[model samples]
Target: MNPVRATTSTTGALVRTGAIATVAASAATMAVAAVGHAAGISLDMSGAPIPVTGFGVLTAAFSLIGVVIAALLARFAERPRRTFVRTTVVLTVLSLVPDVIADAGAATRALLMLTHLVAAAIVIPAVARRLAA
Candidate 1:
């Protein structure tokens, strides 16, 4: 088997795994938030109520965007593993900015931050591992 082909195949598989992991993580976050809301854990975002459906959609969309970034880094970066991990980490931290600044109460902000971290945890390692392989 050609080394390049093997590498490509591994990268493809890794990206797919990362994407799937991201989706699962995002869904889990949404489910947890929904349950919290059902249990009277208010997530009222400055009077802009976030519906369960909206939460799911937004989470999934952003997770997919992370997948795209991983794929792009795998395809284009000189050092895919390092670059992807670093980029995602920075982006993940940046993502917390909204939660921090939102007018939502402490619990809501914390939960929102948790969701972002969860998604990043799932995605960053998956893609980085593939790049290393």
Candidate 2:
């Protein structure tokens, strides 16, 4: 195969993997949120309840952002897998800052953090698998 076509194929595969991962992570996060709610963990924050769908929506959005980061790293980084893993891990940890300081109760805050971790755990590995080592 020609170099340009091969590059395009790889990029396409990366996007496909990212899309699947995004859906999986979003669903998983939403499910976690629902389970937490059922277990009497309030989803309330700042005097408002966070809808379970919100979890999936936000997860999908952020997971797409991660996909973009992975694509960029694949194109420019010397070792795409290593850089993607390191960068995303830092980002995942940073994402919990808001949850940690939110006005919600401890259980709610912990649930939010758990959803973030769940999404990250699903998306990071799936996308990273498509990157060059």
| Clash totals, every prediction | 0, 0
lDDT of 2 by residue, 40-112 (tens): 9999999999999999999999999999998899889999999999999999999999999999999999999
Q: Candidate 1 at residue 17, lDDT?
A: 86
lDDT for each residue of candidate 1 in 1-133, tens digit (9 for 90 to 100): 8988987797679768877876787687788788878878777898888776666677778877877776777778888888878888998899999999999999888878887887777667866787752
The candidate maximizing lDDT is 2
- Candidate 2: stretches off by over 4 Å: none
What is each predicted model's overall lDDT from 0 to 1?
0.79, 0.95
Question: Which pairs clash (backbone N, Cα, C closer than 3 Å) in model 1?
Answer: none
